[model samples]
Target: MSAHTWGSLDDASARALMEEALAAATGEGVTFADVRLVEAEEERLYTDLRGELDERREHNAGLGVRVLRNGIWGFASAPVDGAGSAAAVARRAVAVAGASTGTAPVRLAPREPTSGTWSVPVDVDPFEVPAGERHDLLQRIVTAASAPGLVRSVTAGLNAKRQHKHYADSEGSRQSQHLVESGAMLLAVAADERGAQRRSFPNSFHGNTAAAGWEYVLGLGLEDEATRVGEEAVALLGAPQAPGGTADVVIGPAQLALQIHESVGHALELDRILGDETNYAGRSWVQPEDIGTLRYGSPAMTIAADPTMPGTRGSFAFDDEGTPASRHLLVEDGILRDVLSSRDAVARHGGGAGSGSDWPGAARADGWAWLPVCFATNVYLEPGEGSLDELLDRMGDGYYADDNRTWSIDDRRMAFQFGTEAAWEVKNGKRGRLLRGFSYGGLTPQFWGSLEAVAGPEEFKAYGMPCGKGEPKQWGFLGHGASPSLFRGLSTGVAR
Candidate 1:
């Protein structure tokens, strides 16, 4: 057998190899099987106050086979050479499945077979950019962030990835896709006797990522924003501690996106509600019986799980299991309407009463090596009728918080607390003095129910990050969209 570079293979060759693997599994008496071939390239650069810290480039190519035998699932993966190697991996997966036991017979919800190709629109591929150019970009961001005398240090970085995948299943679905992603972040830190404060641009955890190329990074205006971040970090060093009391609070889009991620996004996964993810992420407060009747939030709250949104980190034509992507409502008019589910989950627990007949397409794996699971895609709260100024005027007196600093949530995802990097008192419909160490806590449902206003589409924005879940902990990139929103009468205080 001759060795072949999977990345260099054309789409036709890749599909043929996967089809051969599925055929081999069926020949071995496997009830169902699928094969995924993946080729990926990644580039990352990091710089700090001292200048360039590190640079990394990586290339990976592999094939994974999933087989179902006797109602049990088995998965195996290895570097691909040709059709012979693919067949061998498939047989290994089938043999493993034959030896396992399952509590209940496995079944998959019906899905129409699909075949197509999709690619993210890109202006310039990051990999094609010179390494020196990438280094210069990071250095400029760091320089701007460190210009402040009170700034103790600065960190800036850029990350990019390109992936090519071909999937084939026994059900006659064959698909190919090419995806490109780019992200950048800058953090400024200041310290004093009171405590250290930090401010970040775009977002906090790993910054913002999107399905685009070098153009996406250029559009962030990191150099222009770095000085403001540094100044804010220094300003927070002398700001008074946030007054502790019950008061209306306004959350900016950046922090609100994370709030949606921890409280609402994780709680709605069907696997968690059904107890499949209890050990890692904990069971959800949402029970199967609560799907139709549960009051999730105020009528102003509407959340949708959509993968069709352009340029989002979670945008993809089809999931790993060959399910076509579509927009599905998870919450409508504050009513619980749907849950993020895999095909198997839908088969086991039928789409709840009042939920639409369409299957929610959200099954995804971190890569070809991991098994696909029910993961949140681009879940976002729809923008409401008002603007930030209007919402602030309505608040009368409250606090405006933005950019998450710390967050804690219980296993059930019901009770939670979050601290923000910066906040300001709203007095007589205008922002007053800045306050430091501002935090808030409340029950999930009640907290959302307090939502009384949201900024209009002009203020809406989305952020992306790698979300960690599952037993072995697969980190998948996802997106969350939000606008500045106002909540009434929540417990507010300084972090304890």
Candidate 2:
């Protein structure tokens, strides 16, 4: 197929191809089978003090088939061409399945067959925009973030992806989806006798992303935020080192999102709890017996695995497994309630056996070349009743930290240390001197148990980042949402 024609097939054509592949696999004596076809396009642009540093555009299309035979699973994938190629790929997957061995037959929890077409709503398609225009926008952001004397360097960039997927299974389910994601970031660096300090706009680590289009990028207000970022980087050059001691800490949404992602989100993956992901990501500190009884946090903490939130990076109409996306609570009223689960995990963990809990529809593949895994979608903390100001007033004296600088978490995700870009002393409900090198440490449960307050819904924000897992190391973008929150006495100090 021509590069220009990749992912060009209409919904009807893609559905027919998927049905043909599923039929071929079942005819080969496979007990179960599914087919996924994906076509994706991505564009990225980076600009710095010198000018455009890097620009990339990529497009690819492929098909993958998964089959089960004799209690073993097999998967095969290759570039797709004409309609005749689907059957060949399906047969190859069945052959691989037949040659494998398993200790027991594979089982998947039953699900109602579903058929649908879905898409992310976008006011303007990034791909349809001119490359020159994108470059110009990034250049403007970089230029605005540059300071000749104080800030030594500045960098900015934009990244976007458009993916089209069609999925079909032998059980008569058919799903097609189109998703678009866009994000941008700006970074500024300044140096002094102490060391170099950097500041980023919107959020850190390549900024924030959403399942929207160019309108989302435009709404970032990079140009408006640029000067403030530059000024903060310069200000940090002479700031006093953070004091070392146990103290109350208020975390801003930008840093809080990451804290939730590392501590709560990863711990809830059922595969990790069951020890199936120990090699790459390590096992979870949570156990199956702890569900619905463990005091994971304080009453102020509630996290939900929701894939139906519009414009979230992880939002989807149907997961790669053809399961309808839905919202479900993971933690409620300080108790561990549920874990992210796939159909396979549900079957193995007794979720569908009248336990009043079914699969949460968390299955996802990085692309057509990979198989689905139980991964986090839009896992987020539910907003509380107060605002950031109210939290500071409630604390009276403490520290305020924002934007992550560095972090370290144990393999089990039980203990962690996090450093933030900037901090301030909150004395008598008033902000005080700026402090540098703010860092904090605690066990996951203890840290969450300290939750005293969370900002209201208006203050909550969601950020997107690539989450890595699996042996071959597939990375998928996911959203983590949070609001500014206050935690009670915790171990905090200045990083040496």
Candidate 3:
């Protein structure tokens, strides 16, 4: 990390501005108000086999204010100009609140006011590195994966971001946070008359992002893995197709993470369950009455949402709403226990989100310009006993799959299909020939209900990616953790 220290809102000018906005909004007879001052930067670097490079960068600094007036909420945001900008935004927020007249008043679940500051610990700040060095890293992965004849093409890229935020609310909560995240990926495509096949290291989307730094990128070791990625892309071209039928299967961590994300994470958001997202993102199949009663999976299944886990993409000291970080079980022993809840959603449900004190601190916004919404953080299936090999042995005969390629789910986050980039045939408890075009489908509850085994903690791994939701479209960083797991009697098919 550089010798530079990140600025905090407690500094003179920022604190003054935040107080000014709060005073302005509360003066207008609003019951609640909060202001967020944010400064952020994002960098993306891309390269391909031919030694060409492309780069993109974005920087934003702004203040957004949210207010509750006459029981309805209103929001307004603007670029931070000076001392007067915050008060102006606050007044505008109140005016916006006046425009909404007929909706029922909103209520927030009670939470203790918290004051503190936190940041992701990093060995090296990615932004301090030179642009040329970043480009070289991407080029190295592309070069390592290139085989002029068999591997026809290679693409690699890196992403780095840093954001400093200060939040203050009328309820006396004050906090500041500095976060940095970075990651990279490599892809190889091999093609001939038989058609094209591809493989990705880490993941297919954005490879393993986390609330870390340049050290996280180094840990990916993309250059060292590139050769294997290239070889796999070539081998896949000649692999036999996966057969179609109801079958037992073993899912590796890489693919299981995605399954957990799409089917369980989104399906359990409290806002989606309350029908607030129905016009945009579809409502959840889970109803408000389902908590603590619905049999969501097998007795062996358990899932938790935790934003306090260190170094995860979703790990934060406090959510955008100023709620302190929390960990809670969304499902326990196959029963639905809680959903991803916001303060307002929890109160709307009459505090039915979680038993006792779990606040479900899952509300977050994409940036300063958007409104905070209920979103998934680190959602994961709790690991069970046994190694991956042992879990496969228990399966006896099945397909072993990893690396997500394609996914399709209904709007309700139910009844879905997912295709993986590679698979292996398991015969008599031993992995045999390679198989390609592996796909599977099942309803959400039914899919999890079939869970037969989960590898122990040693096999557990967390994967991160961007998940898009909401009407104006905010992409939230989501993390999913899982071990190699076994599922029984899934509807399997050949994708290609």
- Compared with the true structure, all predictions reach lDDT values of 0.86, 0.85, 0.86
Give the least accurate 10-residue stretch of model 1, judged by summed lDDT: 1-10
Task: Order the candidate numbers by lDDT, best to worst.
Answer: 1, 3, 2
Model 3, C-alpha of 166: deviation from truth (Å):
1.3
On residues 75-120, what C-alpha lDDT tens digit does candidate 1 reach at each position?
Answer: 8888877659988898889888887888998877777789898888
Q: Number of backbone collisions per candidate, in order?
A: 0, 0, 0
> How many backbone clashes are present in model 3?
0
Show where candidate 1 strays beyond 4 Å. 1-6, 27-29, 351-357
* Steric clash pairs (candidate 1): none
- Stretches of model 3 off by over 4 angstroms after superposition: 2-12, 355-357, 494-496
